[model samples]
Target: MRRALAVLEQVRDHAAAEGLSLTELADTLGLSKSTVLRLAQPLLDTGLLSRDRRHGHFRLGPGALALGQAYLAGIDLRTAAAEEAHRLMREAGGTVHLCVPDAPHIVYIDKVENETAVRMASRIGSRAPMYCTAVGKAMLAWLPEDVFAQVVDAGLPTVTTRTLTDPGLLRTELARIRNRGYSVDDRENEPEVRCVAAPIFDHNDVVVGALSVSGLTSRVTAARVRELGPAVAAAALRVSRTLGATR
Candidate 1:
């Protein structure tokens, strides 16, 4: 069973347009061609794998797509993210937000507040620009190039004095966010607010959402932002793992 699943995973990982040949699969799985064939037989029978008669390459069959669809149907982002957001709020002593991208903006899906923390103006279902918010930048840093181009083309309006309206600077900041594994708002979204955020990924290693710790500038200072960055990133990683992100 383990070997069969490994074979399936290898095929999934190498799922190019032409798929993989028997020799390639044998080398990748470190098994004899006959052994690899034996392992793949059951998968082929179950419709999870298919071999091209002409090219002799193996590819994922319709069964794989069905399994993927079922898995996506069962996942609820807000439910999967709740515990980590609450834990971050408790430990970080700030408001926590779970946001998902909506092209030029990000929509807040869940918010958890520490009782003693200052209340933020943001609420569930509210939208914020992608250029100035930490949660938005966290996701933008990991999303595709076409998505980034779309955000830039939409215009980076200045939300506050600290907001990065220049495309070049914003691009630099996104690169930094990718390198550091997190992003900081630095009072860019709102004059009195600061936030630290990290991206959340789904099973296919796609960026699906973000988690952030938001607080007043007085409480979440420069030093505090630095302190919270890695912690926020670790908390977000836990959420990503729950969603089955391998990385």
Candidate 2:
């Protein structure tokens, strides 16, 4: 069963449009052509894989699209992220935010506040720029190159003295965020406010949102940001898994 699913995944990844030859699938899967055929037989029988008549190459069939549609239909981003966001607020002792990308901006969909922590100005449904805020940067780091370029082209306005207003600098910062698995807003979006955030992905392995912990700079100091980064990242990963992200 696993081998059959692997075959489908490989075809989906490498041959969705153009399709792949049996030999190619065999080489990619490190299996002989006969063995690849044996594993793929069930998928073909179930209408998950089809051979192009003209090219005789394998491609994802309509059954795959049906499965994808069903999976997406069952997923609700806010509900999927709620528990993890609350747990992050409790564990990190700060306000937690769930935000989804909105082109040059991100919209806060949920905010979990620690009762004892200082209340943040951000409210659910509020919008923030993608260049300066931790949650925005977290989503941007994993988004496609064209989307990132569009945000840069739109503008990188200064929200605070620490905001990365320069395009080149923001690009470098995004690379760092990808390397560390989280992003930091060091008083960039709001004065005396600091935040650490990580990207959340869906079953398609596409970044759909971000999870963040925000607090006053005095309490969430530079050292605290470093300490909280990985924990925030782990929390976001759990949310992603609940959304059916394989990665």
Candidate 3:
């Protein structure tokens, strides 16, 4: 089972490269073609992988997406915020994302795409640095200082020209987020993309995750960001309430 799972992860990694041929997968894993086929057969039966008849290529199937959805549904944070995330996408006229802190990074767990012609590049399970993104900063602002320090100690990568690699400046930005009850990403992660996000808390008033609304700067102006700030905060607070957070 463990070996099968390891191969499964490898298969997922190869999905963006237009799936993987059986020979390609075997070569990549340093395993025999027979061994690869044996492992892939059970996954194919379970609908975890789909194969092309002519090309003999394997790719992630609908069952994999179902597994992801099931996992998300089982999480209280994602369950509580799912509707709000969708509603915010409609209300704010942009993409909505729910993210959780993964140490020095933030991982997007769910996203509601914008309906307009313009859209963001982010997808579910995508990751971003803790220092630049609105969702990252929103969670960072409420995290314990020691934990926040640990994140900074892990090396902040320069993502873009606007990314704040300076710890002092980043802290100052987080402080403002704490004061205002929300965070904003002004093309720090992606050029011409701006985002507004608010942190979500648990029953213990511990920050566990965040929700964000993002769009192209041409559509989401500074004034629009200010307008969406409170809206996003309110929506996130509602999700927090569902999770038993009082404050």
Q: 247, model 3: CA deviation in Å?
A: 0.3
lDDT of each: 0.93, 0.91, 0.89
Q: Give the clash total for candidate 3.
A: 0
In model 1, the Cα lDDT at residue 16 comes to 67
List, residue by residue over 1-247, the lDDT tens digit for candidate 1. 9999988998898876679999999998899999999999999998899999998899998889888778767878898899999999999999999999998999999999988877999989999999899999999999999998999999988888999999899899999999999999998989999999999999899999999999998999899999999999999999888887889
TM-scores, one per candidate: 0.74, 0.74, 0.69
| Model 1 lDDT at residue 116 | 87
lDDT of 3 by residue, 1-247 (tens): 8767767888798877878988888889899989988988889999898998888888998889798667545668888998999899989889999999997899999988877747678878888888889999999999988878888899877888989888999999999999999999999999889999999998678999999999889989999999999999999999988776779
Span of 10 residues, lowest total lDDT, candidate 3: 68-77
Model 2 residue 160 lDDT score? 84
lDDT of 2 at 143: 95
How does candidate 1 fare on TM-score? 0.74
